[model samples]
Target: MIYISDKAKQKVDALRAEGTLASDYFLRVSVVGGGCSGLSYKLDFDNETKPKDQVFEDKGIKVVTDLKSFLYLCNTTLEFSEGINGKGFYFNNPNAARTCACGDSFAV
Candidate 1:
């Protein structure tokens, strides 16, 4: 299961209200190779769900991931922050073994 914080939910709701995304659009979370730590996280608004996709809903927001990514992201938490030194959504991934300094990438 994946966890979505209230801040994350608010951001998603605001995005949905903009009407720029498809009704089926969801937050896609995935881990890909090629980061300083050997892997990086990718997040985006996506409208497609593949056969092997795993869907999770929390706080009225939907998060989708492929089977492979699911294995690496189970129990992950999505958070959001706002400040002069911090902004945007942050992934608190229990599966990550190491994370980069910028918090944009990680390795399992």
Candidate 2:
């Protein structure tokens, strides 16, 4: 299962309210190759649900992932951080064996 922090949910809801995303859209999380640590994380808003997709709901927000990606992202946590440096979403993935220096990629 995936968890979405309250901050993350609030951000998503605000984005939707501003018409930045469709009402039917949900968060999509995936792991891909080619990052500094050999694996990278991909996050986006999506409306399509594939046959092998796994759906998770938290605080009324829906998060989706394909079977292959889900294997690498199970038990992951989605969060939002705001600071003088910047404000953005963050992922805490338990399945990651190693993470890149930038913290935007990982390997398992």
Give stretches of model 2 more than 4 Å off.
none
Residue 79: error of model 2 in Å?
1.0
The alpha-carbon deviation from the true structure for residue 83 of candidate 2, after best TM-score superposition, in angstroms, is 2.2
- lDDT tens digits, residue span 1-108, model 1: 989988888878887889877778899998888878887888999988888899998987889999998898899999888779875898999999889898888888
lDDT of 2 by residue, 1-108 (tens): 999998888889999999989889999998788878987888998999988889999999999998988888889999887778644998888998888777898888
Q: What is the C-alpha lDDT of each candidate?
A: 0.87, 0.88
Global fold similarity of model 2 (TM-score): 0.93
lDDT of 2: 0.88
Backbone clash pairs for candidate 1 read: none
lDDT of 1 at 80: 88
Residue 65, candidate 2: how far off, in angstroms? 0.3
Model 1: lowest-lDDT 10 consecutive positions: 14-23
lDDT of 1: 0.87
How close to the true structure is residue 41 of candidate 1, measured as C-alpha lDDT?
A: 80
